[model samples]
Target: MTQPRAVYIHVPFCAHRCGYCDFTLIAGRDDLAGAYLDALQAEIERSPLTEPLDTLFLGGGTPTQLDEPHLQRLLDLLRSAFRFSPDIEFNVEANPDGLTDAKLDALANAGVKRLSLGVQSFDDRFLSVLERRHSSESAIEAFGRCRSRFPDVSLDLIFAVPGQTLADWQHDLQTAIALQPNQVSTYGLTFEKGTTFWTRREKGQLDQADDSLERSMYGAAMDQLAAAGFEHYEISSFARPGFRCRHNQVYWNGGEYLGFGPGAASFDGGVRWQNHRSTTTWIRKVLAGEDAIGDREQLDPEASAREHLILGLRQIEGLNVAAFETQTGFALEPLGGEALSRLQDQSLLELTDDTLRLTREGRFFYDTVAADLV
Candidate 1:
């Protein structure tokens, strides 16, 4: 009777796909909305319910893209699946264009207490370049509306876009600060394969910022956000006190969660499963009384320990050396001795009270450091 502490629902519908997004999403599939909800409900019902969920996250394509009735139906399915904690942090991700009053009302009634808005940039030009449908004005208006409804609001921003100067990045940060969101997640643009930007780059239609410039932008964001009283809790996430994303923490801390919907990923105990990415395939399987899972992997102890190291390093709080040993039965020093020694000698890591964490400079070269450990 193992009950999940967190639940994640993937809503794969979006009005239009952003050029830079590589997430599993379907564009112009609003026609599949009804069937998708039904399948999701069926999937949840089939899942074993053993615990009250502490956190529930509705991440997307755009959860707000669903109509009122569909959204309500999904929420109802969740409520039926497991009992929610009295103080559960229910989070929903919304694009600016979809954050209408009606959607907000539906979310509020559904008990969603946190809103994570996708506001990639405050500059209109950058917005256009990023293929975001919302204008800067609309994003600001949406944030204000969300603030009036949800107790906790997080704003997502992207920095280090091609041709973006340091001043431009700083301006975006300053604008986001003025909005006074409860949390801010700043990420650098990665040219993910299969994304429009990746193809464009290959064809010389788009350029990526140089490493030095990207590093500068990252440093600037860290300094600015910290000065604004946001905790650099994770590599790309910053939050005010008591506002760190609890659902996300579950994943980073190696806890179990159940994911539902097309292209969703789930981890329970030591088994990991991913659903089919195609909306049609997912709906067909679920309607046929079969799970939509396309792949399943049962992690061995060594693989799981390596994952713990990788994910834990993403958090600024770093990994507890002793806990890592207990969880995987593999001592951190033995598994990553050479890399750890090199990093420590370079002053990129600090060991205090059986915990190993990155220094400020270490965070900048995190990819290199993480590779060494692997």
Candidate 2:
């Protein structure tokens, strides 16, 4: 197997947990930040990278939630622990509320090349509905700060909120485009099983956007972002030329990457594993020199092929048939079976001699398409 050239470090601290979030994170856990860093350093020390990494991602509940000193320590620890390619794409996820100037300076000085700001909406109404602490003005200010500090920045936007109209989503898109970010990621809101949103939805306290409205909102994003000269490179991602997010592309391409910290996941040599979700539990295990893994799965050839295809189709460029067969050692036709033909027949998929990609219609129904194939 080839050596992995990417790494992901999860920082599971946040000031407040959004009602819709189900990610592995603890709100009001800043007290544990120091120990978490210590455990993270130990985790990296145990399995140091053999080669300089091409890309690294610091993601979390909110990485910037740490104070300047702790944030600096986290950055310095990662830099000292691993060698980095001079042109490495180092990214950090940040929320608008607590992104202090000191934290921004620490990230910039530490060679963070990209910032993925969680600016869910520019509308204060939607922002409050989403339980985000930052206002539209504050988010815009944070974006300005990020732009000054990083060469490339990405804005994350969520649409199809319970009361969001198409015009409201369009306004948010326009707000993001006005900032001229290097990239943008747009996602429709989802009520995951364990999130507060789900319970509220079940109780009829919260209503989700209906299918037609959701579809229209998604279509508007595709049209508006594209018109603004952003390439719709992936289903939910738009990038200006030459600014695609390298770290996330690694995942979509099914490349191996090492992950550390609680709830972090790693994929290598056809095997995948995740660290424990509970931050305290993970810190304790790593400090005690025990494995922090919570789950592990080894995929056989067929399973791996299925996974590769699923991940590959996420990108607008789709899967290259010849390369998929060569890499997975399984023919796409046989692996995809009748479902492939059915999707094509439904005009939800497009298949040619060399590539297979989702149709514009399919992009909106991606979950359904994945379900059929999976």
Candidate 3:
């Protein structure tokens, strides 16, 4: 098998857990980080690579939450495991408050070319409601500091909170564009099953934005960002001329990638698996020279084909019918030709010769379109 060209390292330490976050992590558990890194080292060395990785992404909990010494040591362990090209796109996710100048220096020294700052909103009220530690002023300040160190900086924003207004969303968009970031990812706030936000909503302690209002905000975001000269590359992502996220593209294209740390998932060949989510379990398995995978599955041919079509449509350029056939070994007609034709007639999808893509309305209801194909 060919070596995967990308790797994602999960840093599972956070100073505090936000209300809506359900990601695998241990809040306020710095002491467990050393053992976590040791387990990470073993996981990285499990499958030695003969070539350098093209892209490396350090994702969270909050990668920047690691203290100075632990941060450097984590980088050292990764460097020993895989060779990185001089021009590799090394990206790291950081919280606005913890990304101090010293942390920025450490990341730069470790060859981070891009920074994804979690600047969820420019509204202080919303930040407090979301349980985020940083203020709007501090978020912008962190962006300025990161901008000085990294070549490409991407900001993450959330919209459609329960009390958010259309004008509030517009202001957030205006403020974000003024920062002149290389990329922006605007996501609607979601209440996952296990998150605090979800439980509160279940008990009438919290509420969510209505569907109509949420849809309006999403549509406004697309138009506003486009007017600002950013390419609407993906549903939630907009980028400057040449600053698309390479690592994320790998997954969207169904390419293979290896991931490390608890709750991290890996896809190779036709199989997908995730490591144990518990920190203790992952550490014990790695230290004992045992596999850390908590679950695994082999995707069948039919399932794989459907996934390709599902993921492929996410790109702004859509799926080229001919290229899709070549890559997945199945023509579009055999898979979803009838549904596609009907949707196109309904003005939800468009088929231009060999290109199959979502129309403007279809992009808004993408989940329905994808479901129809299956």
Best by lDDT: 2
lDDT by residue for model 3 (1-374), tens: 69898999999999998999989998999999889998898888787877789999999899999998899999888777889987899999999977778889989998999999999999998898888999999999999999998999999999988788999999999999999999999999999999999999999988899989989999999999999999988878999999999999998888999999999999995999999998888899999999899999898877888898888788877888898888888878878868878988889888897898888888788889889887
Clashing pairs in 3: none
lDDT of each: 0.90, 0.93, 0.90
Give per-residue CA lDDT, model 2, range 33-96, as digits (tens).
9999999999999987879899999999999999988999998998899999999999999999
Q: After superposition, how far is residue 57 of candidate 3 from its true place, in Å?
A: 0.4
Every model's TM-score: 0.97, 0.99, 0.97
The lDDT, on a scale of 0 to 1, for candidate 2 is 0.93
Error of 2 at 208 (Å): 0.8
Looking at model 2, the pairs that clash are none
Worst 10 residues of 3 by lDDT: 331-340
User: Highest TM-score, which number?
Assistant: 2
Residue range with the least summed lDDT across 10 consecutive positions in model 1: 73-82
Let me know the TM-score candidate 3 reaches against the reference structure: 0.97
RMSD of each: 1.2, 0.9, 1.2
Name the 10 consecutive residues with the lowest summed lDDT in model 2.
365-374
